[model samples]
Target: MTKQEFLRRYKDENLTIGAEYMMILDKISDAPLVLGCAYDQGVWKIYKTGERDGHYIIKEYASENEAFDFFYELVLSKHNRRNN
Candidate 1:
């Protein structure tokens, strides 16, 4: 999915958008969870952000669609776990 499409679809979810990244925040602390993505150096990167350790790269893809697909699933999984 495109960034706009992902945002629209998860408009009700806990998300924060930045110039080069999108983050899914933790409901309790309003801090960013591990789930997020950023674009740099012609590559789309999926990453996990920590409260203390900083961000870590999970994967990289050549296209936004692939990166977003992985990101969307991560968000859905987190949401599902929270609901259940």
Candidate 2:
């Protein structure tokens, strides 16, 4: 999706434009699976590359430390994504 589309889609979700982020991932099938995060509007957004393209937000949080812990679990192959 184009930048405009991304913004339009997630705009109502409270994700601020140009938010700061950090990506930490493990390789799968020779490709770097993006198990990463971005902080916006005082919330931590966790994303991972998967069957769908784009930065798919798996979860959001108010605590940065909690977000990091979530990432740690994800990297260790412990966390599971649940869609609502």
**lDDT for each residue of candidate 2 in 1-84, tens digit (9 for 90 to 100):** 322343354445433222122234222121234556667667877776643455567888787667666655553343222311
Off by over 4 Å in 2: 1-32, 78-84
For candidate 1, the TM-score is: 0.72
* RMSD from true fold, candidate 2: 15.0
Relative to the unseen true structure, what is the C-alpha lDDT of residue 1 in candidate 1, on a scale of 0 to 100? 88
* 1-79 per-residue lDDT for model 1 (tens digits): 8777777777767643433333642211223444667676788887776565667777888988887888788778766
Residue 42 shift from truth in candidate 2, angstroms: 2.0
What is the lDDT for 70 in model 2? 67
Model 1, residue 50: C-alpha shift (Å): 1.5
Clashing residue pairs in candidate 2, if any?
none
Per-residue lDDT, model 1, residue 29, is 24
